[model samples]
Target: MASDLLIAQPDEGPVLDLAGDLSLVLPSDFPRIVKPFAIEAHSRMLWSELKQPLTPWLLMLGFEDVDPKPPWLLPGLRDLQALLWLAEQLDHKINSSGDGVVTVVLPPATQALAMLQLARQGPELLDSLWDPLLTWWTETRRKLSHFDRMLRLQLPAADALRPPEVWRRRLQTLSTCLNNPAHSELVLALIGDAARWPVLRRRCALMPLNSLPLSRIVLQGQGWTMIPLSDSGLPILITARDGLDQRDAIRQWWGSASTPPPSVHWGRGDQQGRLTLTCRVFAPGVEKADLRITCRDQKLEISALEQRLHIPLPEECHGFTPLSARVKGVCIEIEFR
Candidate 1:
């Protein structure tokens, strides 16, 4: 069974910030309780879903041009560094100023980070800061949960990431690079494997393995519209919560669920100046379809799938020759090259 995506909301958790306030400490009125959080980033355990592949059905959440890194994928290193840096600055001020004062305003994430740091040392010398530090810890935890729980709850969105099950079986086959999920990045490893698929390889060539683009299907007044994130004109890989594949027909199929365009397989002839072009035909608004092949000097029709259209080329050409056709109002090029 395919697993549904769980995209994290934007307004969920606050990000940590430490700048001029690094030298500031909470006043006496602040909270005095603190909770525990691991200093290490548990990527696999906490953000397990992010390890999934960049499939057509998945949506990438972070790295948006306008947004910060999503909270779920948030690592403690930054927050911990911000808290420790502020602590160091405050310590220096306490030593130098004789009678020092600091800013009292900060977000809960910072307050939680401060409480963790304030518990480290100099309790006797920093007794004045204790009240605010502990109080902030208690208050912050009241909303964001204790440290471990806080990390657990901060999940990143999966709108641009496909579930692992989508390729689990194929990955287990040991024939492709995906044979080992840990071999490399999920997207890059899949791209390495896509080198074997002519259609997918063509799409993969549009972007580097590390730079997978994202697309979305947004709802208009009544119908849904697919908007591509890239302006490069490469095929947009649409993965949305709603709408059928037919709804976004104008978009080039670039993702896992994308269909291969109609194609033909040329069979070897028996020295009779006759070769068979086996065609797999998919067309617009028809249950059954045929191919209309044309070259500079001749044209022919292939009406059957596996057993049809025994015809000769203008000069028995070798290599791929570009042939054009129209299907479902879209111009489809039949050459696999």
Candidate 2:
């Protein structure tokens, strides 16, 4: 897995925080001196480019090996040699580390520039770095969006030392610093603020309301409450009242929505080695109706008693052909090769 580091340029200097679990695979005799120098250089280089006092940056680094016995063209070989000579110029001792064939988690942006500086170097180096960095940047933005929405919706208590205005200003500062904020230091600071603000703290105490209900079991809380999943599998908010039988409250809440939803399960492989998908529809008023099942455009459709269900086939099920479809009891079984 690629390792991630968040670099925040505070007044003192750039602070590097590990975004995820840090498992660095260094050479057995890794040159400790070079690592710090590379980090310092990269940090300074990035900070200068951003030109902001407190900006946030993210870096992802991973190692991979190109195909063995690669066709090392004359230019490619020269670029490889230039990399080694550059290392030597830093007065750093070089050692035969690992297979020497595998790409190391070298410095991120700077290393890419260094390699791409070679006019005739293969495009593999830039490609390997660009793709992962792009993907990581996108995913990081998504996480920041979720966090920003949460912070904005839940305001701090008025009694806190740092008022809502202060938080708002801080958030604004962060927003100015990062077009899309996911800075580790800022995120941690906001979390710490949550602990200090009573109202925000209470609001941040989220319960696990997104659990699947098994069998006929229903969750009963301080009030008569149940959490049911929506059609898209997102958790619906709980509705409850004090001093009520949970089951009775559930039935009242269910009301028109009490009809059991159709469920599809995978059965064992048949003698012909084809997998079977069995859907059970035991809703009231639909038992006597004829069930028609069909698949089109990678979507499975089932219709009965004026009700229709559409299920998207997972990626693993793609290219699978439906061999047969039959109804037995409440189940509509479909075999796929």
Candidate 3:
């Protein structure tokens, strides 16, 4: 049996968010992992690159003991690399499309930059209001293509005495008016800039709409929506609108797991031999991962499919090595000499 935990960066778009997840194993049968065991667990990651602290434990566990005969180098279950490669190829296709044209989707960061430009150009909006204004824009705008179109709407200087919330709501209203310029009466009521409203409406209407529906990006008041496309410019539906897509995405991100050297220990109860691997996720929401185990002793081999392997030892299964457990891309191998 395995227990899992998730920790992750916030999902808001900055684009530079760290993308990879590292799983930390904290195997325990008790209510919580003991401290020394936990510390040793974190030190297992190659990213940690810490070996001095693990040397003593390595000596004690003797997990590295293996036959001196030429060690067999087998193919790895490298799903993590495949997923990352898929993501990179997708990004390249996105960036290379339309002859390196810029997207119309005004990310929150880009909106802030636009506001700063407006400040320099003598717009009444203050410097401090950029974040709040962009947040309001992001939350209220539902359409994907028309998403960044709201940024073109000019904001009037807000009263310094009023609360920040007032400014956000006011900006939302102004954005609504800008997005619906055909309703002149509504625009007049929401946006006080009578002189600028007509000009904004004309400019927004003239701006070219070149992005195809297949390639267009949108934020649906939650997060950026990803609609993958085929080469023929048709949207390739990967999954339904149900939350399964989210759950699977979380699983892939968190599934590549690593573990410290495992060793034998006393059983919890008489004859109740069990192995519990506690996997902690760097990003939250993933509760499950597939595990495949392969154990071999020179031509006498046994393989446990991801679902078939479990902790409580099955009777007739004497220990065998080298043993390997794979979680997505992570392949933890323990071979005895």
Candidate 4:
């Protein structure tokens, strides 16, 4: 998200000084109705959702016009780096950070809040000092205090003694950068392949792989399921176990196989310039009641009650537009022309 820098700083006295101390004052009617899964894991769901809004707000106040790189690019770069690391774990040749680590490059929440506090307290000093501090760290990865002292040596007596309190606050804010999570730790948490790394089991939380911008490509007859991690479109393959498809294995492990899998088939329709596709619905009452079909780019996503299927459209169907889709008996017929 793009944010405009605050031209005239707010005169409000002593805003929240730390990220942990900040709490969003949401309306009383917030989340009036909750989904079943969110209701069961309310705290986790809230944390996941709140992070989206909170991060942007803190970033606006802290970095604003000072960031050399756009803040939004930080997350995408982290995701891409994590993807390369995942490819490496799957025995694919993908380079990531040289050291096989993907660090969160964005400022941590606590540090961002402190920077905002400091910016409000003394925006004047930051214009001259912040860039050099960032440049020194990027080159030498040295402590900020080292930069602080080195800078103080060159400063004239009168300029350096302007405000003792402001100097102290600057050091405190810059110090929080040291508290950022380790690169390896953050990447491992995102990949979530605990089976390969026993150390990951010790961690309390793991990000769901599906949430990342990744796509699973099954290699038929090769006994492997390839997950494409980058825009290169080449697949990073993982050997399948016990002759079971990776998704089927997941379903069995999760004990959610009550619903029969949807069967799909496509062929040339009765009319010339038309294609017809059909999917068998096991539970007509459930699937037909609140069914939704969405086609975007080259993929079709069908969702109903407790089942979802994502099917990639054939190359031949690219130019054909969707004409009609309807449920009949225990089957859904979708026509394109």
Candidate 5:
């Protein structure tokens, strides 16, 4: 059978030899048909391997070998152009939808520019011009609309807002559109500003809230008492007292403990009906962390480093404390404490 006789020689670049076919012809004729078939099969395999999203540039480079006069070259070029066009469309859609617009638009624009450069060097050059131009026009319109919105919104801007660098080469289009230097600079400035605004806004938003001086304080709920500790005169000290939920109290007191403490031995106290809590204000980041606690009928304040905190239980009290505390973005712990 032909299948049994066909042998592929790897070292010879995929040569397939057929012995059974064309017995009437000389042995040299065997190579004529088999070698071409092997080369075609190899080329098809290579093309299949090249058809990956990450390898478009490599595939484009391989297209350098494609004959400009070949019937297949035009269709293949059209397909590649279609892929690039689709990518451009998807990129615009993503940019319009608040996706990473800068990342989406800039790299593809650069790649299109490079492809255009390569195409200009080749025989069928004009065919290369249409795809990049379409992409550029579509992207530029979207960018301009975005910049207009940013200017209206008083948003910060970046550098890409002007007519694309590629526009200069299209003098006919530029002349028809009346491209003046003043107009060009203004558009460019707006595009640049718009591109940079989001990053700047994000940085500003992530900053810590402004610190404020402590003023007058008051107890907001019943069954809760606020006590003022000895103020160091520089920092403030305050405490609150309420009926204790043991789990909540421990959670509030030791929420920062990465591991369980050896034991939390508490001293017995008289139910003077008042649970006295002590909170000593430490310097921000140095002292015990702040805790904000709210019960059904009371609120309490406790510190992070304090070993013992007094929580008063009132007769007929029906409430539990919910504690929450945040240290900027570094840590936010909410349990009982």
Candidate 6:
């Protein structure tokens, strides 16, 4: 028997009247016994009662239908149109004050699913949803003004937010679906500017070693000084200027000095736009003294050269070592041991 359902006012109590035959059945039996009638009834009831003041009663009824249903059992074409109309109306009210918090009146599960479906349709709807939230956050919810905070609150499911990072591995992915240059530019504009993005700024601040301009150097000998050819390939070059008394000592050291310097080697590694320079020094009967060196953007300065000569060495090794190095705005002492 068909039941005549009396839906009361939302803020009011239970139904005031019932006028048709009643057939109470388990919710599981709703799909079989009702055929398409249940779906039609659900949609019609929602639309007809939505504008009415039946709040608590309608809300309870809507919450009862939350279950896995066959796709064909989903509300028909006309019902979807009605659903969209309701959504658009609710969205308008939420966004009216330019605040992001839209007062969505739907069963909780239904509300989440609707938002997810809207997000999947296009970035436009996503933007519409987000823009209002952003405005609200900026004007009222100041504590949740940041993107990270907003995302955390809105996207509760961890699995849904994993696409951006996972797809960013490829340039095409970033350009096509994740962060297109145009979209990135818009996001940057919204967040103030590129300067406001600390992460992007940090990446920009790194000046490639190869891009640094070259500077002059003076290499001194016994009675004359000569400026040798600057090697752009090697990041570090040590030049020594000896006093008259130390000239002979310097000569002996130069006699044994390898043309390319046994201490120096060069190659490339994982990072792009940079080269690696490796240095090693080993001698017999040395006192294991520490090496002191300083580097500027375009030049290297060796101090306490006498100490570097006294440092002992291991039998064999392969790696890069930095002798007190300084880039334009950075300093790093690197030793891969």
Residue-level lDDT tens digits of model 1 in 70-183: 243555544433443344444444456543123222333224323333323322223353355556545654665565365664332232233233222322221122122232
RMSD per prediction, one decimal? 26.3, 25.3, 32.1, 22.3, 30.2, 31.5
Off by over 4 Å in 5: 1-26, 29-34, 37-40, 54-337
TM-score of each: 0.17, 0.22, 0.13, 0.23, 0.14, 0.16
Candidate 3 TM-score to native: 0.13
- Give stretches of model 1 more than 4 Å off: 1-320, 323-325, 328-337
Name the better of 4 and 6 by TM-score: 4
> How much lDDT does each candidate structure score?
0.30, 0.34, 0.26, 0.34, 0.28, 0.28
Candidate 3 wrong stretches, greater than 4 Å: 1-9, 16-268, 272-294, 297-337
How many clashing residue pairs are found in candidate 2? Answer: 0
Best TM-score goes to which candidate? 4
Q: Which ten residues in a row are the worst by lDDT in model 4?
A: 1-10
Candidate 4 stretches with Cα past 4 Å from truth are 1-262, 272-289, 306-308
- Estimate candidate 4's alpha-carbon lDDT, on a 0 to 1 scale: 0.34
Better of 5 and 6 by TM-score: 6
Model 4 Cα lDDT, one tens digit per residue, 1-337: 0000011111211211121212233233432211111122333433344354344434534643322222234433322222222222222111222222121222342333333234323324333544565455345433444754876422222222222343334433332322222211111111234243232211211111111111121122232233323221222223333454354333232232122223456766556554554433222223244467788878766665434556678887876666666766434566766
Q: Encode model 2's per-residue lDDT on 93-151: one tens digit a residue.
A: 21323221111222332233334234122233333534565566566656666665776
* Best-to-worst TM-score order: 4, 2, 1, 6, 5, 3
